[model samples]
Target: MRKVLLILVLCTAMLSAQEKPGESRFLLRGYAHSGVEVRGDETTFVGGSFNPIFLWRQSDKLLFEAELEVEYENGETLIGLEYANMSYIINDYATLRLGKFLLPFGTFAAKLHPAWINRLSSKPLGFGHDGVGPARDLGVELRGGIPLGEAKMTYSVYMINGPALNDGTNPNVEPEEAGMLLYDLGEDNNNNKAIGGRVSFLPLSNSSMEIGFSGLYGKVGNVESKYEDVAALLYAVDFSYVSKVSFLSGVVDIKAQLNGVQVDDASYFNVEDSSNYSFSNKSSAYYVQMSYRPVNMSTDFLNSLEFVGRYSELSFPEGALWTSDQTQYAFGLNYWVDWRTVVKLSYQFADTGAHESEGEEGEASNDAIFLHWAFGF
Candidate 1:
């Protein structure tokens, strides 16, 4: 941890020292949110986050960017390096980036994750930093945009240290539990690397609609006698649409997104007891949201207020080791205090399906309410 901090400090100093005369060399910006929530009759204060982002323009084609997030929760403080990367723009068709950064598998992680940008107070199920999808990775990436007539296309391809696998030795650990190997930021467990990319298309020149496809392939596990290598593959499709419509004698904005992922099964063997194991796992998730605002209201507060509704779900195949399928319904109101600040209140209804074992079943559910204030600069 000390080494990481030292590296960041040294990088910052180097960038500052390289600044040319009369030119601004660095930009600092980030977002934060604080809130209070009630769940199952228990209320608590949400301490929120203090994130600092730095950007250094080394030259016309070279740039450096990094972000550090400090969060407090339940009387404990946690700090994380969200991303740090250097990029070189070779041309309009290709840009290369190196170091740790957010995965380019979907639009949400890179585009809509900031507290001030996202419409909801909470993330969708199976899509958080440690959720089923890949949030970030240490790797090298090639990304660029292409102009095609009146439309456009963008692409990102990368190679990185892939997910880590379980050795399948502990009796309490099932083979299918390997699905939990989504985000491993430490050392690479295996010699192989993962390859992934996403491609997006905008068919209409004047429309805010985009369609995308993403995929990943890699092998998980070490090449040891006790452990068998597992081939991991994932594929996803997503789309987003945004538009303005007239409503209630005012203008309302409509925005929505849908996406899902599929993963292949893995096989392994235990050498200690000559046991063979296989994990058949497949999962998917999706969410849709809509918001309405009365732009022409007489009062400033009423004009700044917006109402929102959303529904999301995450599901897995039956009999899987992790068997709790979840669905959530949420409604909220957001008031824009200014261009960079917002106050939000939301209520969520969550239902988790029953897990069946030997004819017995149990399920869980919750209802929660939250009020939060967010700002960015």
Candidate 2:
């Protein structure tokens, strides 16, 4: 808490120092959301969050940015740091960044995660908090963009403290988290650092479409431990396309991404007994979404209405004790109050796939409806 206060004071001092021409620039912006959810014979006012982003531009070549998330849950207030990073432009084509930053493994983490920006009330399956893919990390990054004649290309490369795998051997670790990757920041359990990056291309001359590929590789075990040799490899492909169709009299937007994770074969301690076990240690997740809005229509209310649909899936390694194959279908209707504010109503259905002995038909869970209002400031 003291560190956060210090940082805020420094930002304020910097902003106050800009009394002359060619001075620095400071900006405060972020998003917040509040909502209610309804399920089988139950209705509850969902929790909410206030996320504020701070930015300080010291010069044309140097800048700092950070984000904070504050939420109230379980009768307690929780504060979290999303990221805090300083960036320096090295040249026209490259820049250097250091400190905690969101992983660019996919566009979602680094780009489209703000509550006001997401069309649906909830994120896709196996995504967002405690998702299957990597999120933010303390690291050094090199990023830039290039022009390919009429097309464009961009890239990012980074390295950070690698994630640690839970093997159910530690008393403090939960048995349900065994065989899963954990991103506990502050210190490294080993000397190895994770390496990752993302590269994307916009082949369309108008820049209406983009395709991206990203991956990360690292050793995920403690040094000198029996699981030291265990490593992980992950990859993802993502795409976005948006166009204005005259025939439909509306704008069509489509986005999709698929992520795959593979960990080296390893034996893990069975917390239930004095034994060990191993599995494929492979998992994957994906989501496809589309939305339409009659922006060019007649009245303000008519043009502000948007319809969205999404399908997502999560496939966890089945042999693990805490594993399941899950799928989600979501549909939403949004009212755009403005460019940065929206009221959304949505419904989602979750299906849990059966195990080998549970038969073919998976068990379906109760579907629910959500009403949320998101604002970006």
Candidate 3:
């Protein structure tokens, strides 16, 4: 804990001493989300997520950002850090960032920005805060944008050297671990490291498309005899289109993994066949969503009273993977309260596959409707 505080202090001191002309601003912002969640079996959980953020910009190229979040469930409170980072711009084409920041991975991971709250679902199916990966990591990142005539290209590259696992599952009692890959290797030094990028192109004034791919490979150092480290691969693609009648958008995501028990001289699984098993798991899902804003600049309601709908499906084969199929549909009406706030009402349904022992057809999923208030600055 002391080390974490020390690092934050050092980053803050560095940014305070460097400031460009007319490039200083301090801002505070936040929002809260409360709603009832119903599962496929009709179980309901009433909960809410409240996040508060603070940002300081010393210059157009140097800035500090942070967020603190608390999730409330009944009378219990779960508190944690969401973001704390200091960024330095090298030039118009590059920026160097240090401290804890969001890992630039899947589209949903980075796009889950706080201010853009109401524009999305109460929960994004399998992304951040959903058990896959931690929201932020301690590391350094490089990100920037390039110009191409009337259109532009954007990119991000990052390397994190903190907790290898996001679930507080690390076995190390020390602050940070570093060493070699073989002689000094062993299981003592397990850390998280990754690299990824994104590219977008605009062929028209109101329409644009993007494709992204990211890979994460690391090990959770200490594990029980029956569990080995994990190697994972993830792929994603996304697109969005805008027009007078409606807007169309979609995303496809896939994940595959390989993992097992570690081996030693006295280890169980050997070259010969054995009862122990190694597993290969794969899961993928996709969604097509569209919304129609009947009111436009030339119409009444001024873009209010819009209607939106979405459909998504996910499936995993029945082998080593926890096989299941899920389908979700949502409909909503949104009214713009002001330039930076909006009110929304929505309904959603989800269905999951059944086990062979159940022996009956799966039942229709439960439905939920919610009213949401959102704002950002």
Candidate 4:
């Protein structure tokens, strides 16, 4: 990965040299956030990660963009690349992106993950590595925007290295993680590639509302492994609406999404207790949120405040040994210092239901309070 980045940098130099003076330039931009959180009885500060984005425009047809993440985890500082891609414009309506990039599986992961734009300090439930979908992946994709009369439409489609399914057949694999799918498997484990895309439509001429549908189908098994034939079909439906309501004298925003994942059934052996198990491998998650800001209020302080609430849930297959159901509720109030800066106070609680086959382990009190400050630069 380092060698590839170096080569891209050299290519950028070559492109810049060929361009007329002042025709090429570079920009640095991204968002950072810091906060305090009280999760159950544990308290900590959330400043462990920093994200930076780099953009270089080498003429109109050629451009390069990359995002790097630096974080402290488990006693060490780690640097990781979220995406490093070069884009070539095919025309006014289409562009091709090559290298690692954020997957457009849903609107939130690809478009609204920035700290200042997320409206809340924490991400919705059913997201992240072991959740519903992938954050990013390596491959190439085609993206475009189209005008359909007064309404607008946008799309993205791509193919990437196959995701790996953890069957927990090996001694190192945990029984609870057996049916999970890992998108960042580092390298391809089979000859097949994963293909997926997202399409969103704005039906109104004002573009105040959007509806989206996304899907991905791929083989998630190693070629020679016992679960080689296992495959997965994943899909999501999402929607967003933002507008000012005259009656309330405020702006209301609503966002929601549902995710479904189905993997081909495969037998899993628990190496710990010498047991075997298998079940219909299916998982699903969903969340709904609504927020209101009194932009039309006479008092500036009242106008700058926003109220938010959300509910989310994650459901795993029932028979899996480590399977569990998770439900979460979050509420927040935010004060905008400016267009790009905000202070947030929020509270959230989570409920986890243990796998039925393993019986109950008692519902643990998983709740949190957050005080965050976010900015975009």
Candidate 5:
């Protein structure tokens, strides 16, 4: 990985030098965020952070993106190439993007590549892998738009295949086998494919609405788990209303999964003998959010604030299902630092159900206050 990254940087530098003076149409963009917080239990003194991002876009034909992060929990270093793709412009109607990129999933997941697309809080809860997998993947996709009488429509379709296991932890072990086995007897079946799509419509010149749906079905059978299958489905609807004086946006996100004869995680998988757990078990999570901004985009500086809030719920039969339901409330304030950046602060409250096991620490009502600085170009 290190050698590959070095080569990428060198290639980007060469591309930059070859361009004529001020004639190069190449683009570069990046973002960084860090937060320090004292949770409801202030004694924890938790601090979380992520390193800066780097990207090189050569006239939209070729692009390279990467990120390096140091986790605060255990202080582990993680680095990966998020995107290194080549794009072909097929006239003005559409563009063909081939290589490692984002899948056409949920609204938030699709827009995660651009830091300024939405508030940072809208992330995390929706995607897996701590919002990383929720972003991009090793895949190929097509994206573009079409014009209508008074409005326009946009769309995306993709076919993706890559490692589903997370970087920091082993995704093979069942949650029930916490510290029992260090390795799996079965072969790693990360070789799988997925398909997804999304579309948006604008009935008026300045206002728009979108509905998206995505599904994945794959077989990851190796020697040990000969018939293990992993699959998932997602759906979402987004509405945005923008006028001269105010802005309102709302979203409904839903997701479900079925893992047959496969070990997903302790909470979602069961591998015990004669358990007969091979049947397709269904699970889901969803959230509804609305945000209203009183200030118009024409404002010079950070001239206004928006009141935003959301409610989310999740359930899993394999996990502590009775105790898995939760509700969260968040309030945010946005300040424009410049044309490409904004500073945001928000607070969240979460309530969980009671744990079924006696050893578990049941449910707890907790609060988290966060401050995030987001920017893009």
Candidate 6:
């Protein structure tokens, strides 16, 4: 508690410090939220996050930025440095960034993840912190945007310390199991670095539509015998559209994303013999969401409300080592108090695909309701 308070004090002091006349030296901003959730037969109180962001303009061409998050969950507190990086603007179409930063693999993870920005309360399936998609890494990156006639194109490329493979005896670990195929942070078990990037295109003028594609490839696993070389690859494509229509009398927003991953030489062919292994790796996931907000409405309350719907799924091939596949459906309503504050209510239904036990087919399912208040400043 003291440490968290001290960090906040330091941030406040930095933001409040006096600066030279006509010189913009620093700025601060962030988003936070808290909520209560009722799931199945249990109800829990949640302390969302106290995320603070700092930015410094050292010179005309140099800038520094960092974000820190303090969160509480399940009677425990956790702190993390979401991103800390420096950027040097080379020109109109190129900027260099070095240090730990968010991965440029997907639009949602890189751009629309802040509590104040995301329309939905929860992340899509297989795209959360430790899900199938890569989140952040430590290294250097190049990114920028370019204007082409009436359209725009943006790109980001990075090379970072890749994920490490789990060579443990147990194959059912939370994240690193054969079925989960999770990646370790801050360390690379092997010497190879992962390389990936995203490219986005805005094809229409005065339109909020973007199309993007991303890919990442690298090798994971220790150099020791029996666990030598496993190659990992990920690919994703996403699109988003926002527009106002006459019939709906509102602004409509739609987003969709699909991603897949493959890990070569993932499992051993012979459980009794470690030397016998095969390369049969496959996994995929996708999500889609739509929302509408009335514009130019007469009443204040009606103008603030928005309706949302979403569906997502994650799957693995049949006969795979792990026996789990998941699908989710969600509906939500958001009321914007201001540009930087919101109240949200949502319900989610989830199903884990059939599992056979004792020659009988059975499925697992869950239902949950959530209420949250979020703000940004």
After superposition, the stretches of candidate 5 with alpha carbons farther than 4 Å from their true spots are 1-26, 43-73, 112-117, 120-124, 128-134, 162-172, 175-192, 220-224, 229-236, 244-280, 296-302, 318-323, 354-362
Per-model RMSD to reference? 8.6, 7.4, 11.4, 7.8, 9.9, 8.1
User: Residue 40: error of model 6 in Å?
Assistant: 1.3
Question: 192-262, model 1: which lDDT tens digit per residue?
Answer: 89999999998889646788888878876556633436656766666776655554655444444444444
Ranking by TM-score: 2, 4, 6, 1, 3, 5
Q: Please, what are the lDDT tens digits per residue for candidate 5 over residues 1-377? A: 99999999999998997764642244444554445554776633333434345555655455455444334564554554545666776667677888766555555554533445455443434244422123566567788888887788878877665324311124554434321211111233455565656677776765445444444434323223423343334344444443443233322222222111122332233334323222223344555555555443455442455556656555433332222444556666666576567667778777765434435442778788767666664
| Model 3 misplacement above 4 A | 1-23, 35-47, 112-120, 131-135, 161-189, 203-207, 218-230, 243-275, 297-302, 354-364
> Candidate 3 clashing pairs?
none
Off by over 4 Å in 6: 1-24, 169-176, 269-279, 317-320, 354-362
Q: What is the lDDT of residue 14 in candidate 6?
A: 78
Q: Give lDDT for model 1.
A: 0.75
4 or 5: which has the higher TM-score?
4
**Candidate 4 has what TM-score?**
0.90
Candidate 1 lDDT at 105 equals: 69
lDDT of 4 by residue, 162-256 (tens): 57888786557565688888776668878889999999999999899999999999999878988787899999999999999999999999998
Which is the better candidate, 5 or 6, if ranked by TM-score? 6
lDDT of 2 by residue, 126-202 (tens): 77665777878888999999999999999999998967887777778786567888773657778999999999999
Candidate 1 residue-wise lDDT at 324: 65
- Model 1 quality (TM-score): 0.84
Residue-pair clash count for candidate 4: 0
Candidate 2 lDDT score relative to the true structure: 0.87
TM-scores vs. true structure, each candidate: 0.84, 0.92, 0.69, 0.90, 0.68, 0.87
C-alpha lDDT values of all predictions: 0.75, 0.87, 0.53, 0.85, 0.49, 0.80
Q: Number of clashing residue pairs in every model? A: 0, 0, 0, 0, 2, 0
Cα-based lDDT at residue 300, candidate 2: 93
Candidate 3 lDDT score relative to the true structure: 0.53
